[model samples]
Target chain A: MLRGICLEVPPGALVRIEGGNGGGKSTLLRLVAGIDAPTEGRVGGRPPRTAYVPERFPVALPLTALSYLTHLGRVHGLGRAEAARRAAHWLDRFGAAGHARTPMAELSKGTSQKVAVVQALLAGPDLLVLDEAWTGLDARARSELDLAVAERTAAGAAVVFVDHDPARLAGVSDAHYRVEGTGLAPVAPVAPVVPAVAPGSRVRIRAAAAPGSVLPPGLSGRPGPDGAVVLTVDAARSDEVLRTLLGARPPWHVRTVEELP
Target chain B: MTALLRYQGALLLRSQRWLAPFVAYAAFVAVGIRPGDPVLDSLGYAAAGLVPLAAWLVRICVTNEPGAARDCAAAAAGPVRVHAAALLTGLAGALLTGALAAAAALLVCDRAATGPGAAAVAGALVTVVCALTGSAVGALSGRPLVRRRGYGILAAALGSLLALVLAPSPARGAVSALVSGARSGTAEVPLTALAVALALAAATGTAACLAAARRG
Candidate 1:
């Protein structure tokens, strides 16, 4: 039970909640999302439109992904035509268009998560609460979600999220807090990495490819200032990306594939 | 409220939350009624047996309160409105069941001048009462009993049975009076009993709101 907790999510802010297992992170998100009330505390100034994505999707419901999303959109007060449109848009954005017609129970875990996340964003809520929403997404879907979060914050929607990875939203979150004991305490932001070798156990590679040639779907990084492009892949998938880069008809010239310190 | 109604209608349809209750209602009507039987007796017996099933439906709707849906609704509509939506859903369920009962009455009962018509109307009202009361009982006991799904359903069923027993004019003195051909002429409902049912409904609604509030 959370007690004496005080929270203020400023408009347009991206707030990251950090804590270990059983540290009350989910409970905090639920309270903030208004899913539950605190035993003793006042939640002042709740915005009119709010959306929440829970950690677990209730997939046993007898609804197709599109129907579920449309139902939620309507719940948020959108017209049927508009709700249907938004549902399609978000499903396509998350690369789950095929599963839109599939029953929620039949979708893969990753697809189900995509549906869960898209439903929260369809109405463009003033406050969005997400609890471990990124856990089961593919790399491309993850990046799409990252971009969506940035877009929402840019459009002045406050976002509260909990992701296991510490680097999930590095350099983007406006505020961070740790849930401990019974309440929230501010976390000092970590300094940015501005070195040639970035921090982490990620596999980083530099390759020479034609300018503006799109990187593979699962890799994330930047285009270069000169000829070589830099990208990072999850250590588990490093070999997969490397083979794709080397085995292309017009193969990309590989420079380095070193483990980040 | 309109938006909530539409959304809820969609959920009820696609999720098929109505299947169990509707099936139970239909089965009760179909199996119990025979041609040339007194409409009231058949209906009353069917309704009595239906109490537990209807209460189970209400209990499922009000309790457990799907975490994802509740979270989404809490942020948008607030807990008060969410409970209101649940109340609305319950009412709609009652009305639908009432309509179905009316249709059954029309199908089974003979074309009498006035008695059958009155009986049909009475059947509809009792149907609503049974539904609303069962829904109310579910709301009253659900939050406390949610984890024990079997117990919650049983409690709702028992509570609803108790309410029904007290409801008939003994309350159905109102319902039975409507039946057997309104022997005296004017039909007078036991206002005190109705007041009790409505009050229970209101109290259960309030409890549902408090449950949402204390869910943390």
Candidate 2:
């Protein structure tokens, strides 16, 4: 039973939701996805093309994966051929294209999850809400979903997700909120964690913007105690991120630069 | 809306959940109507059988999708729309069954009692009235309204029984008109009953759709 909760997800933003079991995180996601209407107050600005993945995909539907996704794509307002094309593409991307003709009930758990994820991604929705959507995925599919989330946000869509894994999309999320006892509290964004990159290949930059000045849209990081921000970027892109910071009007002051061993 | 309907229709068809109610309706028609039966009486019996069959079919469609799949569809298309689509699919299936039964009765029953054309038209209207009334019972008996499978089925059975026997029910009025018309050897369209059933179904559908969104 959440109350007095207000969240705004801007275009291209990735919002991560954290909470204990039965903390209303799923409830909040459902409201955001427009699956369940709030009894009080209002959830506005929901795009018509919103898609959601529920926490569990334990279904024994008679439909084959491809047909189900195609139907969902159509429900999302795609033409039949276009819907089928996109469904096949997403299925293949998730490595479940081989199971396209298999009945959903006969598919393995991981494959069923892939189909669930594919349905949401196929339509390219403006708002994507996921509740523990990666729970049953294999390692490869999990990373694929991470990439899919990144791609969605990169394409200027708002993505809201809840997962048991704290490290999932840790650094890439634009904002974090915890549902605590019927109220929402914002948690400071964490430093980006790029798992594929070795420790030696990462760079950390510390900078502080002038008071009343906002950071560049492309730069995101954790807030330091003294009002400074620490951004961790790929070593290759550190120079570009720094150039944007220093090149701004009344430019940010770069306090320190370091390489992690 | 069309897409939703198509998806729901596919779910109904592919799931094979339609078999039970459909076979039940067919059995009811086969047992109640005979080749030598009066045309109007047989048509009335066939239409009356549709009330329970429609209610059962709507229940199946409304609850066919698992919770997670339903949520997915609800998110893609609003929950109200998903619920409405399920209701319409079940109603459409019931209507189709009702038409087939009525046509079979027109073929086998003795048509000498009344003009075949008028009887066919009247049977079609009466079929519509019963199907709409059954749909109303169905929409109110499933999912958000009843929730429990045992209680929902019980409600549907009782609701269908009441819709058939209760004097105020549009289905009852329409079926009675057809049965009495068999005696008078005349066809009655039951237009007023049809209007009432339509309104009843619309109200029931609106209530069910709102409940789906709220309860979800």
Candidate 3:
């Protein structure tokens, strides 16, 4: 139901699409991916090789993750042996190698999402369309996808992605567009805020977790002299680390957070 | 195209959807063989069975597309290529079924055949044609039975069966004629029906590809 939207994605650029719920984001991606044709105005210059990662992965087919990726790789014109190699490579890259033999219907949400991203990246598509593809990934895999996006653009491919996080690709976006009122409007870019600190400056946070409880992912900590967990984190990512700790299942209760002199 | 064909073949094999249907259809055709009937008669039964097998394949390949695969491959391979691959995969399945039916007919149901080898060839051809016709009709329908879930595929199979069975078509009789391996008269289908089936396969296959591409 897009009304008036004119967008240009140049080669070697990263474009981000932003919109609230039901703002025609997915529909626009569909049309851009050539899955749906535009009704009135024409869409021009779509590359011959393109790949899309939908927000939801359809995993009911009776296929293993590797088998599905191999099929799609072949669909993108890779030979059998090459397709199998890339399938296994990408699965391993995304930590889904263990699930290569697992049926599509049996994968967990995070692992299934990894397979979804792997398939899109398998053939090195010229145009990559991602619709909230980062929603369910783990921290490492999510950043790995960040690196993957950078690598795709570096290789002269255009990437269009929608992620729920505003902080996503903060400094890397070549252009930003917002979906509004049945169409799209360009969003003015804002300079990223990088809090200047001494190169060696670090942040320390002390917390207490229940006995035998594991620390949350992306946070490293050890027991202090008083038995409270003393966590050391890079000053830049301290907030994220702290949030992750607080958001842990058992909830690491912070006793103190300070900068070590 | 070759890679896509191979990919599809591998995907279909991995899915194993064809196993149950193939086994069931084979058993059904075997049971229908009367000991005294012409070995070629079983071919008609096999050809008839091929219609459902083909329709079922179409349902699996065309109707049950993964949203991720469909979207991801659409722009890369184009809808035309993707849909063609799926339909061609169905064609491959049909050919395999046809070959199997031929072997079974020649081995277990050989009575009126002039030569086992010739009868086998005729049986395979008729089976393949019936399947092509079945898949073409389903592709042309433009309705993806997957929208209906369990009932959709069942409905597609039954509907194809009905269209093939009730049309007073010379298809079944024509299969019998071809498999009879007579050197002269009535050994082939009327050119009109053959022409129609060929045209339908071409036209409807292209249309089905377009329809699949257009779908969300």
Candidate 3 lDDT over A177-232, as tens digits, reads: 99998979999999777767667789888888777677776566665555478878
DockQ, all models: 0.54, 0.61, 0.48
The iRMS of model 1 comes to 2.2
List candidate 3 stretches off by more than 4 Å.
A193-261, B108-122, B140-146, B150-158, B165-173, B176-186, B189-191
True contacts kept of each: 0.65, 0.86, 0.72
Candidate with better lDDT, 1 vs 2: 2
Off by over 4 Å in 2: A191-261
Q: The CA-based lDDT of model 2 is what?
A: 0.92
Candidate 1 lDDT by residue in tens digits, B101-164? 6566557754343465556655655555555566676676565335466776667766766765
Cα deviation of A74, candidate 2, in Å: 0.6
lDDT of 2 by residue, B1-216 (tens): 999999999989999989988888889898999998999999999999999999999999999999999999999999999999999999999999999999999999999989999999999999999999999999999988999999999999999999999999999999999999999999999999999999999999999999999876
| Tens-digit per-residue lDDT, A1-261, candidate 1 | 567777789999999999889989998887788777777767777687888887777566567889878877877888889999999999999899888899877888888889889989999989999999998999899999999999999999999999998878878999999987877899998877444433445888889888766555555666575547877766666777898888765678899988865
* Deviation of model 1 at B153, angstroms: 2.2
The deviation in Å at residue B195 for candidate 3 is: 2.4
The numbered model that scores best in DockQ is: 2
Ranking by lDDT: 2, 3, 1
Weakest 10 consecutive residues of candidate 1 chain B by summed lDDT: B181-190
